[model samples]
Structure formats: structure tokens, C-alpha cells
Target: MKKDKNRYTVFEHEALYVHRGEQKLSDAQLKAFQLFYKERDFPYYSLVHNGIRFCEYVGVIKVGNLTIEVLPKADKSNGEEHWRSILIDMMRSTGLFHPDSPSYSSLKVKNSTILDMYLELFATEVERLMHQGLIKKYRKTQSNSTALKGKLLIGKQVTLNAVHQEHFYIEHTVYDKEHLLHQILSKALTTVVKIGTASHLISRYKRVLLDFPEQRDIKVNESLFDKIKYDRKSQSYQTAVDIAKIILLNFHPDLSQGSSHVLALMFDMNALWEKFVLRSLQRNAPDGLEVSGQVSKDFWTPETGYTKKIRPDIVIRKNNEAVAVLDTKWKNIGDANPSDDDLRQLYAYSRYHNNVPSYLVYPGNENKSLSGMYSRAFVGDAQTPGGVIKLKVHSGKRDGMELLNQNISAILF
Candidate 1:
């Protein structure tokens, strides 16, 4: 099948209607997605009548022969291609799965999908690591050795080597490239080869796998990635490992659905939006002002349980004093009043942060920043703390980062 024939593109919160026996999802594929939703427990999409409505999560979800690409949407009128590029740029800004400089141009020129880009990135990392030489680590081996290079187990030697005196049963340590990190990367390369649809990416992955050192295949899990510790020797493999983690962890093979595999490279739009804004602010912050994210404050303490903490999305400080608090929303609220819950949340954040000005940031058609004040700080208090809650809107155009940087400049300076 042709690429366009099999690919279905939809925006976030948009519905992709499933046809019974047409160009859309088949019954088996729909069942596969249903099983994925049930098993993964992540609300990537919700089941509608004869359709799958994608939520805030955006990325590629490959089910059998159909490739569904869900891209983020702040403006409902924008087409798929525009949002695709914006999504790529946003992912790059947030240090998510993005290709290196060399591979990036080729991918862009070829107009590759998210999966293709990720696979290309992984392959590029593997190629770079191979050129730099794979790191070797000390691994213990238990075998019969002709040369006594390591410790000899007396009991094993006595029992196993009784017949053959020429061979000694020993436990020895040897430095080699076969380790957890390499094994994980190797597994990811294999996965990329399996689920990857792009011919170029598949070939590249295969070539890298050929050059990659032979590693003992192990069952990869979330815990295995946690065990990887990068030192000076293995520091260069961090990007490859991170991409590999994303690939291997998200790739799920459905046995009940037969040969269909579900690979969902989805990101929470809310979190990504917050991170992008935070990174933009951090990069463009002025002198004597610091920008931090997920700054926590103890909101409540229970006598028998853990204390509840409130974390603002982005908090700005000057000389360790809370100057401003920004809460980012990925949704577009045009010309309408802000939600009461959001306003109240910002109010709470302001009250906790010593009455600092808190802003509710959103993506809008144009740059609009408005300042408003709470008439009274509390219901009972007659006096107001004079804490202001501002609304800052970023024009989510192609130059969104630049616009966001400008917004940050205006707030910080």
C-alpha cells in the first residue's frame, strides 16, 4: 500500500471515524486499539460511536497496516501539515525525540513521519556510538577455562573438572561491550526494524544493527533503563539510550490481535506545553532572574499521611523572592472569560507564593496579555493583598518559540 493510502492524520481531540470495510480502521484494528487503551491505562484516546477520539496526547499510533498520526492543535482551522511541523519543532524545543543535525535535514526534506524521525534519530545515535567505539564493561563469566586467568571455584572444579584435568572450572571477570546499555540499544534497533514503515529507516536500522556488537538479548522493562548509570565512559550513549527507552518501552506486540503491533509514541500535550514554555523562559531569562518549573509548596499536612504539595507550572524568582508564577494551558480560550477553576487555582498559587503575580498562559490567535486583580484576597477579609492574575497568550505560529521568548522577556524584564 502507498504511504498516503494507509496513513490517517488527525488533530488532538478530533475523531477519526472507523469504517467497517473501507479505508479506515478494520474491526481487528479497532479491537487492537481498544485492547491497547485497556492495557496501557493511558487516556490517549476515548472510544466514541464508530470512532476513536484522540485526547490531549499526540503522536503516531500504528495499528496493523494503518498509521494514525495525531498532531497537536491549538488553532482548529490549521491543517495537518502545519501542525506536524509545529509539533516537530515543539518536540525539538523540549529536548524530546528529535533527530541530530545531519539526519534532521534529510528527514525534513523527505517529509518523514514521527516514527521515521525517531527511528532515524536512533540509527544516527547508534552510528555515532559505533564510530566512537562501543564502551566496554566488566562482566562476570562462569565457564571452564584452559588458562587460569581468574578465581577457580574449588567445589565446581572438583565436581565438573574431575574428569578433565586440562580444563579448570572458574568464575572470571572479562571486560566486554556486552552490557545492559548495549543490550537495550540493540533491542531497540531490532524493534525499530520491526515496526518501522519507512524503507530508509529500516535499512539504516539494519545497517547499524549489523555493526553493533553482539549483546546478550535480555527482556527489556522500565526497571532495566533505571539501572543504567552513565559515567565518563558511557556518557555519549545517553541520547541513544533515551531514544531506545522511548522505543522499547512503548512498542507493544498484541498476540491476541494476531500480527498487529501497537506502537504509540504519544506525549501529554499539557505537560509538553508547560515544558516548552519553561524551557523557553529558562533559555531567555534575563540576569538576576531565575525561571524554574514544577516548584512545589507544602499546601497541607496530614497527621498520619504524606503532606500534600502544590506545584506551580513555572515560577520566576528574583534574588530568591517569588516575583511571578505562570500556569500554562495548552487549550485555546478565545475572547472568553477564563474558567473559574483555573482562576481559583491561580489565586491559590498566588496566595501561597507571598501574593506574587500569577498568570494563566494560553495559546491564542494573537499575543494578548491582560492584568486583573482580585477585589478581595479572601471572602472574610475586607482588605485585598493586591495580588494580580494576568492572562498571557502566545501566538502559536511557526515562530512560537520566538513569540514565547518575547513573552518571557516582557514578564521578566
Candidate 2:
């Protein structure tokens, strides 16, 4: 890989001094990195000075057009390649992204960088989508025209404007093939042309995007993607649509709120880890348990209205009762024990969910243990049935889902 002298790289969830030998980041470089650093919500990257540390979730981030890949830091014994494998496994556990997205038989053989993998997968999906052709919808357009079209407006407004102007208020049905998916793909391809490293692949995608006429150069914003829905008729478009969604979500060239030249694309490990755990439990919960996320119940219902809904991450319901509440934290639990804040939160969950078992799951070393605690002050009436907070420092060293199952089995089965 060709190196850019100006480019500075860092690892995910890592802390390091931004220095080369005795020389630190120039004032301008510090300013630029600080902007993206703050945007990621990473704590303390705001302190832009010598030895100022920065870390964030995994993905290729950008400051302007420069790439800053946040690979998970690994020791010499394991290295980043192994960690990437684990990350991929976590993704599969979620059942969100396709298992064989890159369509490669094995990761070991591919010897591909993460960006390479993303690019290859995107290219393949685009090729498949283009082969299927764009989806066509007969959209009805209304206009005041010289001649009648599909249907003429025969109301008072027609007489007020169309008749006086000697034109017909018409609704016309036009169909070919132009949609937000293609427009998003076109914009993403434009990004590739600007920042992509692979010359051959960039050329290929550029041609595919340019194949459409000028009318299809359709600029798409985030709101456009939100209003779109897919039904059975459009189900075939799911793969391409998903790819476009990921691409657009990660890439932002000229956002309305930020600098026109600013670029930052990253994934939050906390969110990803939480989702992975939820999916795992959803798939493996006991026969009686139903795994649900963002489970909320009103804490206070006044005479007028309700307030303060306590929503926990994952709640295990059995026989329409919350049996357990699970909160997955991305931090490693080896060095740091569960915090007072975490314990208090779990205690609150215990009260909110009728004193059910609550868990705080975290990354751990090989030797892991579960700890349980009780809070008398939080839940006032001793007579009420539920309120136990349990914490498990589960090992992320091996198969994370398996580790989770082993930990959760003690409480449920």
C-alpha cells in the first residue's frame, strides 16, 4: 500500500501520542483531526496538543480525503487479522449483513484489506443489481399542460387557472427506471472516484454509474432513503438497496451541517456489540423466553399523562413477564470492575421490571466469573417480589456468543 506522508493512522479504542520521533502534529493537522475526533463522540480528543490521544470504533474514517482506519489493536501474538475474523463473526451473529457479502470462500486466502473487502462486495452487488435492471414505477405527475394527459382536473380550480390560461390541468403517468437506489449508487461511485485507491475497480464502478443519462444523476439526501419501502414486488432489490444504504450511511462528502470538505465514516462498537448480544440471545434463549430489545415500561403514570419510561437494552420475557434484563457493555472488564453507575442502572432495571434478574455483560479474560448484588434502598417495599442485579465478566477471548450462552444459562436454565 502506498503511504501518504500527511496521513496519520490510529487503532480502534486505542490511545497514543500523535507524534513522530520528537515532532508532534502541526497546528493545522491537530485542528483537522480534532474536528473528526469530536464528531465521533470520542472522549477527550478535544484536547488538541502533544500527546493528545484519540480512539474510536472500527471503520475507515476520513478527515477531508485522507483515510484513518481504526483497526482493533492487537498484540504481536494475535495481530489485527485475527481480530478482524472475530469482528466478522460478531457481524454474522447479528444476522444483519449477509454472511458471504464479499462472496469470497475464505478470509485467509483473500489477503484483502477491510476497505478492499467492502469495495469488492459493493462492486459485486452493484453488478448484480445492474444486471437485474433498475426498478420501474409508474409515478403520476400533475401539471398544467397544453393538452390533456392521463386525466384532466375537472374542478373549479381548472376553470380558475387552466381554462383562463388555455391549458389543461393534467396528471400523466411516466415510467422508465429512475429511483433513489440508483441515485445513491451514483453518488457513492462519485466518492470512489475521489478517494478510492483501487484504480481498476474505481474505473469499473464509474462506468456503471455513468451509463445512466444526465437525468438519473439524481442527487439524493438522507431523507429520501427514509421514505422508501420495499414490498414483495421490489424484494429483488433488497441486496443492492442494503449495499447502497451502508455506503451512503458511511460516506458524507458535503453534509449540510458540516464543512463541505469534511469526511468521517465510523461504526460504534458499543452499538454493534449490544446488537450482537441481543441477536445471540434471541436465537438461543430457552423455550419459554422471548428476547426483545429497547423494552420499555412506564415508570410513572400521573393523573394527566405518563412519564419516564425505563427502556433497557435486552429484556427476556417469559409468560408475558420480564424474567431478565441484559445490558451489554463493549468495555473490557478485566482491569475495571462494574462501575457504581452500571450497578445503579441495573438496580433501577430490577425495580422497573419487577425485581427480575438483571445482567451487565462485558468483555473479559479467560478466567471469568458472575457476581450478584442486591439493593434495598432502590426498591422500597420489601414485600414486593422482584429485584436482583447480576453481573458477568464474560470472556471475549474466544467465541463471544458461546461465552454469552454459558453465562446466561446459569440464570435461566
Candidate 3:
């Protein structure tokens, strides 16, 4: 990184005194003075006389005298502009700025854009803080009244009465600064990984597809298929499948009999998770593999005002056939296995995609035994298909890319 000379006072002094000002001094003397100044503040008279020469040597500000420098102290407004510029640069460095055409100009910096960039950088933390109820809003009001009578007015010219009232309120939420800062840092990290992984997958797929277009086809004869399936030409397909599986595993909701609360949380997480997954697939999937997110299809239903609209998280297609339908849920899956709701949703996805095999993925517990639950549920039962399979995602302990690799391997192979 280039040093920001303007940031330091010594450089500023040197620029002002030696370069911009008419201060005259021998090179050796100037060097000696600078060295002395580094140890302690320059005496007022020496600075006054030599400040110009000193600044010229340093190459920052032009110094006129001890009391005055050509470079004035940054005023509040100028300082604000400088801070804003720094923030814009930060945004550009963080990939928030457009590479092709710069969004920031030399003149005015967009306040809204700056704010949005800050929010994006700190959304996760902000959201977490909000969830903890660390921020709150309230309101207040006031009123007054009086009374009157017709008899009073008549009596005396009588008695009389009157009334008056007033009301007002103000409201806003206060945020915990410490908690907000912590959350922002945490979320920023998570956003980077999520974004980076997606980008990598997309780039990888684009390269493979460009290299081998033939591998994009979904339907292939058994003999030729096995030969090219694991070859370099098929790398894009493999990557797409892998990325999709990982997304499904991390984002899928857990389903159990009559558990509305867990299901709701699962749905919320799935919304974000699926979006990331779709973006990744789009970035990396070969042209042959048609990857789409939240695809909506409508069919007439029993109700007059309602139509059956199906939106699948991911639909991976090869040729005309919908090869796979993947739905992500954030719910934790237990040993008890797939519930009726789980089966029903997958079945719906399959039906919507013309009987395609649908996968429902959820997070799995690390130290728990799922075998016992499976055995109990399958006692004396033959291998009955058309049910959801439970996949455990140990995202908390493992690398995201590695976890995704495992998911893709399971999905494709």
C-alpha cells in the first residue's frame, strides 16, 4: 500500500516549509532540524524562521512561519469530505463499487450509497443485535381540558365556561454500540465467505463449460456417459452438483410432526441460504445444467381466488428433464427422521417437476445416533422410496467449501 503522506504532521510540515514556501536553508541543516523535530517539538522561533524550508524538504505543506503554514488545518467540512472519500475507497476495496464504471465520482459522494455500504458491511451484526432486542422505540403524549356552562353565561351575564387541549410525542430506537459493532464484524466475515465461495464456483463452472460444451447435456447413453462423466469435460457438471448440495444442506429447514416454531425459523434461514446457493450455481453451472431459483409455476386449484404456485429453491436441469429439485431448510434434523410434512413438500416439488427426485437437506447433530431412529421407523419395512432423506451439515465445525464438496459428491455420484 502506498503511504498516505498527508496523514502525518511531519510530512505536512515539510511540504509547507520546504517546497511550497520561500524558506531557504542548507540541505544538511534542514535534515538536522527534521531529525531534532522527530525527537521533540521544534522551538517556536526556529519553526517560525525555518518552517518554510522544513516543509519544502518534507513535501507536504508550505510553512510561512512558526505560527502559520501554507496548508491550513482541515476545517470540519473538509474533514468530513476527506472521511467520506476514505469510506468510498473502502467500499471500492470491498467489491461494493462497480469495476467497469466507477459509481463514485471526483465531486459529490452519495450519502445514501455510503450508508448502504455501511449497512451491508454490518447488516448481520445489526440484525443480530435487533434480534436480541438491544434496540427499542417508545412514545409519549400530553393533554389539557376545561369546561363551560350556558346557565353561567345567561345568569350574569352569568356564569361561563371554556376548554383547551394539547398533545405531542416523539419516538426512536436506541442501539447498543458495543453489541452493534461486534455483530457488524461477525456478519462482515460471514458475508465475505458466502460471496467468495459463490464467485469461485461460478468462475470454475464458466471455465469448464467454455472448455467442453458437450458435457452440458443431461441425457447420455450409459456407455459414453460413464466415460466422460468423471473426465475433465464433466468438471463443470460435478462442481454445479457439489455446490447445489452444499447449499441445500446448510439452508434446508428441519421438519417434524406439528412443530411450527422450528419450521418458521427454518423457513427464514432457508430464504437467505437459497438465495446464496442460487447465485453460486448461476455463477458456476455449465450451460447444460440449467440452474434456477424460486421458479414460480401456477396451476388451477380448488379455491376461486387461489392458484397453486410452486416455487422451488433450485431446479437443476439437463436437456428437457428436470433432473433434480433441491429445497434448502435451516431446521436441525434429528434421528427421528423425515416427518410427513417433509415428505409432502418434497413430493410437491417432485410433482411440480414431473415426478423428479427431490432432496430435502437439513443440519445434522454431530454426536447423535440417527441409526437407532431409522431402524425403529423401518422395522419389517421394505425399502420404500419416495421419501425425503436426512443429510447432516456440520457447518459450525467444518470449512464451508469442504462441506460443500462432500454435499456435491453425495448429490452427483
Candidate 4:
């Protein structure tokens, strides 16, 4: 038996040899494969059993160079009604989807076709934005007009291209870029449907695409963000602009020129986990405190004349002063302890900010708490003293407001 040359499949954390497998990949494709994971600060693939093993993040991402055959993770959704609740919850944490957002609350991560979940979420957002009214911009148009409209295609008259055709006179018309909008939506809809098989998606997407039936297909690198104007009259399109940015950047039409042309609806678990915790804490934060992410620090650079940079994942500020810092990791520490890399990162973030309460938050509990000191002495510090606290808050593991409420309560308290 042989797999398709363009398709490459592997289970979560499983491995396959792309260079020497049945679906042998080229050097460019392999680089694209490694680049995606590496950019997220994770080892994209592991050389185990002579195959490429993916990390826990499961979804379809086109390397265009290759189609990742991603299977689901070992942990089933425990037969929860909305098994895909994890994805929904994680996405909700990003603040991209408003709590009151329509067409999103009912989404579920089913046992099979998890990739479909991403498509649905993306489409749901797209549809929501479409309902808000698509942004329109005056685009210069050139065609033979039945009646005189604007400037004529004057240069073409000497060329005798359209001048001879009196019935369709050459003229320019400033029209809305509705055609461009259609192209973008059509391309994204086409890509999402092709990503996976879902009977329901076809109709939903068909409806969306049907809205822009007259519009053409957009090409790679074609974007209208810069071309469109943002004013009070067009303020309705803010959400559409945001959604369009995500779709244009992640959606792809074909597997050409590598990942650039491939649609990547997948999200990095590490980032998603961190954002979810931060947002959860921020939303539920006490009245006296505030939660912020990637907080800049107070530092002065003497030699380079550039301020020393250190950004903690989530910083809890009390009345504008950072009181506590929390770094979220998506790893599970069932029995094994937190890794040194995580420890050092949190320790430095603490020390750089006047010895604040630095904490390491993992999704799983090791049933034990540990702390250590780091300083200039390489063992301890006195002036800028700091330590690391390992804590667990599995917000993504289970559904229901109870677990989420508990996780947030435990992490913050």
C-alpha cells in the first residue's frame, strides 16, 4: 500500500520519516515542516522510530509543501456533550470571539474531524463579520461601458482594441471593491472545505460563497487592508477587518510555494494556554488588581544604550505596579517536576522586576509545590532576589464553568 505523494499523516506526538517515507518530501517541504514548529519555540518533529512525531497540538496546517495527517490526542473528551469544548474554551479565552458572539456558542469538538472545528470557528467568525456588512472602497475600474461613465480607456483607442466596439464604449467607473471581498471569502471557504470532510460545512460554506458568486478568486499575498479606509461611517467593519486579517494571513488556496500558500488554522497550544489563563484571570480579577500580558519592565541599558527587555507572560499589577507574575505552560506534569528552562525563565522575570511573586503555571498537577532562589551568586541573590513557584491550573482539560472557575480561582489565589 502507498500513500499519496502530497499527503503526509501522523498521529499526535507520533513520528514519520518525511525524507525517506512512502510520501517522500523535498528539502523545501521539510524545511517548511520544521520552520512552523520551530517558530512556536517547540520542536516541530522528533526523530523517533525513524518517523516525524508532532507535539500535542492537533489540527490541519498546510505546509503547502505537505499536508499534515494529524490524528486526535489520546485523551478523549470523556464523552462530553460538546467534546470540542476545549477548542471553544481556548478560543474564547483569546478575546477574539465575544461571549455574545453569534454562531459560536454551540460549536463542539467531536470525536472525529477535529480539524473541522477550526474551520467552523474560522467560518463562524467570517459569517459573523459578513453579517456586520462588508467594507466597501472605491476601486478604479476599466471596461467598455454601455453608457459613458467616467474617463475612457483613451490609450486603447489608437490601439483599436475596444474603440471599434461602439455598443460597449470604453470608460472607467469608480465602484466598490465588493468583488475583492468576494474573492477573499470564496478562497477561504474553498480552503476550509478542502481541509477536511464535513457534510454540514459544505452547505454553510456554499451559502457564504454564494453571497459572492460574481466575485473572483483571490491570489496569495493579495490583501486590501491597506487599501480600505477606516472611518466612523465604516466603523461597522472593524470586526470584519480583524476577521479578514486572520483569514487572509492563515487561509491558502493551494499547496504551492510552501507554507506561505497553505492555510494554517492551527494555533500553538503554548500561546493559547497562556492567553486563556491570563484572560480568565483578568476577567475574574479582584477589584483592586489588574491583569496584563507581555508587560514591559523598568530597565536602563548602560553600554548598548538600549533598555534591557524582559516580558513576563502575565503580570498582575496592583494600582499600576506589578505585584505578581505568572508564566503559563501547556505541559502536563503528572509526576515529573517542572523543567529547568521553565524555572529559569520565571526566575529571571521575577528578579528583573524587583523580586515579584513569580509563578510557573502548568496545566497538570504534580501534587507538589516547589520553589527555588536564583541570583547573581548563581545560587542566591540579595539585592534583586527572586524565586519560582510551580502551580497547576488545567483550564483546557475539561469543560463546564465549574472547572474553569476553580482553575482561575486556584491560579490567582
Best by the TM-score measure: 1
Computed on alpha carbons, the lDDT of every model, listed in order, comes to 0.77, 0.60, 0.37, 0.59
Predicted candidate 3 versus true structure: per-residue lDDT over 2-42, tens digit per residue? 22232223212233344434433445434444544454343
Question: TM-scores across all candidates?
Answer: 0.88, 0.74, 0.32, 0.69
Worst 10 residues of 1 by lDDT: 383-392
In terms of TM-score, which candidate is stronger, 2 or 4?
2
lDDT of 4 by residue, 226-310 (tens): 5555578555444434555665676543343433455554556677777877777877887889889988775556775677777
RMSD of candidate 3 to the true fold?
Answer: 29.0
- Stretches of candidate 3 exceeding 4 Å from the true structure: 1-267, 280-287, 366-402
Candidate 4's displacement at residue 86, Å, is 2.7
* Steric clash pairs (candidate 2): 355-386, 355-387
Error (Å) of candidate 4 at residue 302 is: 8.7
TM-score of 4: 0.69
Better of 1 and 2 by lDDT: 1
**Per-candidate RMSD, Å:** 3.3, 5.7, 29.0, 6.3
The parts of candidate 2 lying over 4 Å away from their true place are: 1-9, 15-29, 34-47, 50-56, 72-78, 100-115, 140-172, 197-200, 212-214, 254-262, 300-306, 375-412
Return whichever of 1 and 2 wins on TM-score.
Answer: 1
Put down candidate 1 lDDT per residue, 1-413, tens digits, no spaces: 13487788878887766674334777777777777778877578998777678899998888766788888877767666667777777787788854454445555522556776787777877887888788889999999989887889999999998989999888889898988888999888887677656565677778788888887889988888888888988888888888889888888887774577878888999998899888988988888889999988899999999999999998999999988888888888887768898888987887888777778888766666666776663633533232222323333444656766776677546
